[model samples]
Target: MDILHIVGQQRLEGTVSISGSKQSAIPCLAAALLTDQTVVLEGVPEIGDVATMIEILETLGAVVTRQGDMVTIDPSRVESMPLTGAETRKLRGSIYLMSVLAARFKQGVVGLPGGYAIGPRPIDLHIKALERLGVSVRNEQGVHYMRVDRLVGNRIYLDLPSFGATISALLVAVFAEGTTVIENAAYDPEVIDVSTMLTNMGASVKGAGTDEIRIKGVSQLSGCRHTLIPDRMEAGTFLTMGAALGRVTVDNVIPLHLESVIQKLERYGALIEATDDSVTATFQEAKPVDIRVFHYGGFPSDLQPVISAALLQAKGASIVVDKLYPQRFRHVQELRRLNARITHEDASIIIRGGETLLGTEIEAPDPRGGAALVLAGLLASGETTLHHAEVLDQSYERFDQKLKELGALVWRETI
Candidate 1:
């Protein structure tokens, strides 16, 4: 395993360029399977989950070539095969393939998805939406087998606006025989990016970044080139890091995507300036504030952990409510190791700040949790050792490198 060692209380100063959206790029890779032509994707993040997705693509017979942040996927030579359950277990993004494969090959098998074990992200919504689209889905043991004789578009309502389910529905409905309407769809920028990619590929998709999505299905989809948007979560992470350390100017970011985070951070007394494509955050002091994580246009649940780290030095009491993932407070125990005063009740985490954090060895339960640990280390008084820190690769590429660029003393040590 690899451990990350950080010498805390160091001021961070420099401009860091945000990478492309890992969330958006994963679905785009799966959507490439919807066509038989060559699809070129630019601005794809070089993250571990993406590499795993590319491996899944190649395993299923797609000719994939990568250079820097660009990936060319040739699906003309693709073949229908049961995706390896073990491989699918490596990434929760692999569930995006269920809809693509069912639409393309009429039948496929995928195992229970895995990624950050933040909470139980059940695929019931995905299954329900797919069943509404005339697909027969069954779970045998832990694997899901889905088949469709012919997909007929219909209105599908989601119980909640799940980003994964919305993207999965779009993938499945892109090539259906008629129109498909998705109500209470995810209003995430990533969803809009996928919709835009499908539109560029000649699919009629509208109402992305809104609660309701309308998709006029087509008989076929052609390949096209699309550039991914910058990752807002990564931008938020850096911003939170800035709140704990010193100043961080994030480049290559779409300011609009960071509206919720910027609003919250500013409310908590962090100095933030946003331009068209960049955001600069300078921390003065941490202020206690209550945060509620919601769907898009709200504080992202993905950013809950990092922000929690930022709240460690808050003046008073702070409460974090994560409705999306109730068990997202996995970092609480690890942060406690750094002497953070935090407690939880159900889905809410209460943080009492004003404690001087002393660094100690801790473990990262997941990617976001790992990031929170790193942030805690940034504010702590001594050396912090984070175990299982390599999990950051799942979403972030060159995270340690980026932090080092910002003047943080971070290094990877294999143990």
Candidate 2:
């Protein structure tokens, strides 16, 4: 495993253009398998999960050419095959391939997904949605096999608004026989991005940024080039880092997508300015404030940990409630290893400020959590060693280089 050695007590100030959304890119790559034309994807992030998707596509016989940040997929030579269990177990986004394979071949097999050990992320919602669309789903030998002789659209109501389930349904419903209505769907920006990609590919999809989505079955989908929306999560993470260290402006980002995060930062007394495609966050002198995190349409649960790290340098105690993944506070213990005053009780974390963090060796529990650890290390005193630093490759593209460019004393040391 690779480790990152970061020297702290430096202000990160620069214009950093965030990478493409990894959450959006993986689903778009899987959806590319629905058509047998040359699909060119621009602004794709060079991440481990994206690399896994490319490997999965190539295993199914698609000709994939990756040059710089552009990925070209030629699916004319793709053959119908089940994704291996080992490959499927590497990333949660692999489950989205089930819908893509079902749409193209009408039969697909995928194993249970395994990513971060955050919490119980079951695919029951996905299976139920697929079954509603006239697809036969079965769990055999730890693999999910889905077969549908003919996909007929119907009224599908999700028990919960799961992003993965919503995207899966959209991918399969585009080629169904009739109109498919998704009730209580996820309205995240990534969902809208996938819907936008589908619409650009000649599929009729509407109500992307709302709780309900409707898709009209198309006989076929054509090849189209679309640039992915900037990663809101990445932008939020960087903004939180800036709020912790110094004033920084994150460019090439869609500010509208970050309203929830921006509002939360403002509530915590950070000066945030938003434009059409960029957001600048400045913290002249950080003041501690209490915050309550909610679900989507509110403050996202992903930003809670990063925000917690920033609050460590504040003036008061801040309480963060994580309603989505309660166990995401595992990184709190790791952060405390660096002399942060954070204590977890139930689903909320109490962060007391005015403690100087001392750098120490820590492991990245997950992707987002690992990012929080890295940001804390950047602002800590002395040298900080982060194990399992490769976890950042799942999202951020060239994180070390970017941090170095922004005046962070970070370097990659292979062991």
Candidate 3:
């Protein structure tokens, strides 16, 4: 396994460019299958997940070409095949393939998706919504098989506003018989980006950034060029890193997408200034903050771990509740290994701040939690050695290199 080593208590200063959204890129790449024409996506981040998605696309017989941050896919040659293989099974993003394939071909086969197990994300909602669109689904062992003679649009309501399920619904509805209304849909920026892409592909989609999304089914979709939005999660992680020390300017970010994070960091004594496309964060004498992870346009669940690590240096007590995924506190235990004063109680993690962390051996289990461990190492006194640190590559592109550019004393080693 590869390990990451970091020497702490160093001030971070410099400008770091945030990458394109992994969340947006995955679904958009899957959207390429909705059409047989050429689809060009710009600002695609070069990450492990993107690589996996590309591998799946190629296996499905799509022609993929890359240039710098741009990726062009010719899905005209795509053929429906069982999305079974080591690389295909390991991607949670593979679930997005289910709807696209089902829409393009009459039937689709896929196995259980793989990724860092943050918690249980049951696809019952996805199955339920697809059934509403006249698709029959069955599970054999760990694989899912779906077939439809022809899809007819219907009003579907998600029990919870899940981003993945919402995107799946949109993909399926694009080629359905009539109009489809999605109630309690996810209002994520990624969701909006998908809707915009579909619209660009000559589909009628409206109210994407709202709880209710309406999609008018069309006969066929034509591919178009689209640019992905900046990654808000990456920008938020950098902001949290800045809260520990020094001034760091994060460029190529959408300020509105980071509203909740910027507001929360300000409450923790971090000075944040946002322009239309960039944000600058500076550390100060931090104070504890209480936060609860919620849906999009609220405190983001994906960022809970990084903000929790920032709260470690705060004065007094801070409480964080992960209403979205209770199991997200895995980093609390890893932070404990570094002598952080944190405890888990039920759905919430209570953090008593003002504890000087001492670097020690830790583990990076998942992408977001892995990022939290890296942030903790930046504040610790001694050397912090993180095992399974390669997990960060799943979503983040050039994370260690970007941190090093900002003057972080970090390095990766194969061991």
Candidate 4:
């Protein structure tokens, strides 16, 4: 097993580059399955989720090649392979491939959605959207079997603005017979990113990053080269690290995409300077603040764990609430193991500031939990050993290495 040995009380300085968006890359790769040409993607981060998507594509007969940050996916020789239960069960993103396969081959069999158990992410919305697009969806055991001869586009009103359901709607609607309208859609930037790529590939998409989206089906889509947006989630984590422990300049990021996180950091007495492409943060005496996570354009639930970890040094009490993931207090438990004063109440995490955290052996429950544990380690004075650190590779690209580049004392060990 892989573990992280972090020597605490060491401040970080210098610059760190953010990687590509994992959110955009997954749907874009699924879009590639709609075409027969070679779809080239630039700035695709090398993460475990992406690697799993690539492996899934290859199993379905897509030719994939990777050179650094560029990925070339050729679906010219694609076939309808029975996506085994063990295969699609690797990650929740694998669920998107089900619609892509059904759209291409008229039928598909994929296992149920699986991945980080951060919250209740039911796939009922995905199935509902697919069925609305004229696809007959059935569940036998834990696998979903979808078959559709012709996808008839229609109006889809989602109960909630789910990111996965929005992507699935776009996937099935692109090759549909007529126009498809998605109301109460996800307003995330990744939705716009996927829409832009689909438009470049000869599909008609409009009103992305809004409550409503319109998609006009095309006869066929050709492959096109697309560039991914920066990973704001990764950028936010690094920014929290800088404001909590040391000074760090995070580069290769989109400032507007991080407005929510930046505002919170600045309110916490961190000196923040953001340009068009980078943000530099300097830590000072912290001021406690309440953090509430909502949908896009609001504080992201994904950053709740890491930001809560940073609030430990504040002078007073801080409340971190993630309504989207009520059980996201796994990091709070791990931080308590290191002698931090924190409590979880339903969807809220109450953090008592000014606690001297001591380093000890801990484990990460998930990817973002791993980031929070690492941040807690930075506040500790001794050696902090973090097991199951491999979960960090799921979303973050060279995270510990980036911290090391910014002068953090960290080492990766196999024990």
Per-residue alpha-carbon lDDT of candidate 4 for residues 212-298, written as tens digits (9 for 90 to 100): 999999888999999999999999999999999889998999899999999999999899999989998899868998999998898
The residue pairs in collision within model 1 are: none
- How far residue 22's Cα lies from its native spot in candidate 4, in Å, is 0.8
In TM-score terms, candidate 2 sits at: 0.97
lDDT, candidate 4, at 415: 72
Candidate 3 residue 404 C-alpha distance from true site, Å: 1.1
Every candidate's lDDT: 0.91, 0.86, 0.91, 0.91
Worst 10 residues of 4 by lDDT: 81-90
* Per-prediction TM-score: 0.98, 0.97, 0.98, 0.98
Residue 93 Cα positional deviation in candidate 3, in Å, after optimal superposition: 1.2
How do the residues 255-275 of candidate 2 rate in per-residue lDDT, one tens digit apiece? 888888887788777889878
Off by over 4 Å in 1: none
The sequence of per-residue lDDT tens digits that candidate 3 reaches over residues 1-415 is 8799999999999898999999999999999999999999999999999999999999999999999999999999998899878876788889988899899897999887887667788888888889899888899998899999989999999999999899999999988888999999999999999899999999999999999999889999998999999999999999889877789889999899999999999999989988888899999778999999899878998899999999999979999998678888888899999888888987799899888899999999788999999999999998999999988998899999999999999999998
- Model 3 off-target regions past 4 Å? none
lDDT per residue (tens digit) for residues 161-227 in model 1: 9999999899989878789999999898999999999999999998998999999888889999999
